[model samples]
Target chain A: MAGHFKQKSKAKQDIPTASLPDIIFMLLIFFMVTTVLRETTVQVRTILPKAEALTKIDQKRLVTYLWIGPKKLPDNAIGETGVQIDDALVEDLSSVRSIMYRKLVEQPKLIVSLRVDGTSEMGILMDVQQELREAGTLRVNFSTKRDVVL
Target chain B: MPVIKKKERVEPFIPTASMADIAFLLLIFFLVTTTIDVDTGIGMVLPPKLEEDVIPPPIKERNVLKILVNEQGQVLLEDLPSAVGLVRDQVKKHVLNNGVDPRYAEATDKALVSIKTARETPYDAYIQVLDEVWMAYFEMWDSEARQLGYANYRDYVAVVGQDNPIREKIKAAISIAEPDAA
Candidate 1:
């Protein structure tokens, strides 16, 4: 009877799952390596408008962002829209040219991506464009959402 | 009596049962932290800033397609109140109207689309109009490319744009003036 039981156990082979942990570990390492943390926290409120003609930027490393919209909290109480480059709010408009020029020097193929609020006035938007042009950063993209067609 | 020495051997195994659990925890952490936001938008090349004002060559009124957006978000196509949806069609019509009529574009090469907006015009309206104008040119190029036996305008541009002078000239002909404040 004992020999019969051993024969039945041999016939019922277990599937080997020894390598599954190693595979999962490799996947975990890949995800950890490729993950990029969020860089800058947006200070101003921005609602990008939707548009039909949108071209995606291929190289993210070559692009820089500039945001324009109303300030947050008590600052908004002052009733002045603010322009932000990365983290800080720009007080003077002319300084935009110099700041962008410095960035252009670092990355020659720099593209200025303007994230302007939909409700914002065109005057400030155009001013930023003019500054970018002055800085020789002619490649500009107006960041917008993809228009949803039902 | 003889003195005997024995070899002490022990079996060892690294415990890996918890490895999968650790990996799963890490995977969950990455999944929670990952943000896959893709940046895309309408791109334009701004003309270089000029220190001195220079008079542009006089373009015939017939050859220029003027689009203006006022502060009230009303669109004016050649001083006529028009709907935003009509902008692309009107622009396409004006560009391809290469007829002998003096009031229309003499040819595609001579046509120019000029966009001007009021200072207080909403950015949304301005960008929408600009996007429509760009679409007009894009569609024209795409159709022209298809007629030339290419798959699409992007294919034509990629394969022929660099070495082909005609293709380059055709691309250069479709021009939009720098956006101005009304």
Candidate 2:
């Protein structure tokens, strides 16, 4: 019995860790491949509304976001509603047509995603739509969350 | 004279002990920064700018279901006061009427749901109304698909491409009328 106990105790106790780096490298490569670096920092406050009927935009490359919401002012004060395209807040509504037109020239199949805040009025959204219309970029999406039903 | 001893052999190999730590550091950085949230939304196609010479097609009033939403988020269905929840049933009835109800649409193809909102209408209110309209169409499609031996409309769509005849049979002809300039 003592000889059997001593033989059992001689078995390898530590787990083999030689492949640990390889495993970690595999995980690291996966993350690197799937990672989509966030390019633009959204300046406006866009709390999207919830809805039931929704569709997924699979092609992220084709989408250009147009944010319409109250401006995030200094000291957390909400300023007047504004339209933001990419990084810059649009100062002139008419200029939206030119910027979108230029983007359309680059990528003809561009889909303009309107990320409007729930509390915002429809006036600004309609104006953006008109500009989108003038730009000949007909495809648009209204970004909303999925409404969960109990 | 001193005898020269054999030089001690040293195994030339890269140290792999810290390799895992380095990879883990990078992995953690990416894991912390990466956000895989998929975007979900309602897709729409905006009408192109109309030319001055182009005359818009005129449709009969009975074929169109007008849903007007005011600034107060109050819904007016066909000029009648209606709630947001009632929109789905009403839209379904209007689309599937098929000449049975003179008050509703004449036929499925002739049916057009026009949603006109006020300039000051809340975005959520408008989305709610649009959502109801889309839900009604989706339910109709679901039933149609079930009749055709499919689980749901999405399944049917997956089997048959977007250009299927059923899509043409019960088309979602929703029109968003531009709000008058504020």
Compare the candidates by lDDT and give the number of the best one.
Answer: 2
lDDT tens readout by residue for model 1, B1-182: 13332323434568878888988898889877875577889887787776678865678888878888899999999889999999989887877788765666778777778778777999999888988887877787788888889888888878876456444434433233455524
List, residue by residue over B27-96, the lDDT tens digit for candidate 2.
9999988778878999999988989799889988989999999999999999999999999999999999
TM-score attained by model 1: 0.84
- Report iRMS values in order: 1.7, 1.0
What are the candidates' C-alpha RMSDs? 5.2, 3.3
| Model 1 Cα lDDT, one tens digit per residue, A70-108 | 777664543468899988899999999999999999999
Across A64-146, the per-residue lDDT of candidate 2 in tens digits comes to 99999999999999999989999999999999999999999999999999999999998889889999999999999999999
Predicted structure with the largest TM-score when compared to the true one: 2
lDDT of 2 at A118: 99
Global lDDT of model 2? 0.92
Quantify all predictions' global Cα lDDT against the true fold.
0.81, 0.92
- Per-residue error for B80 in candidate 1, Å, reads 1.2
**Residue B65 lDDT, candidate 1, scale 0-100:** 80
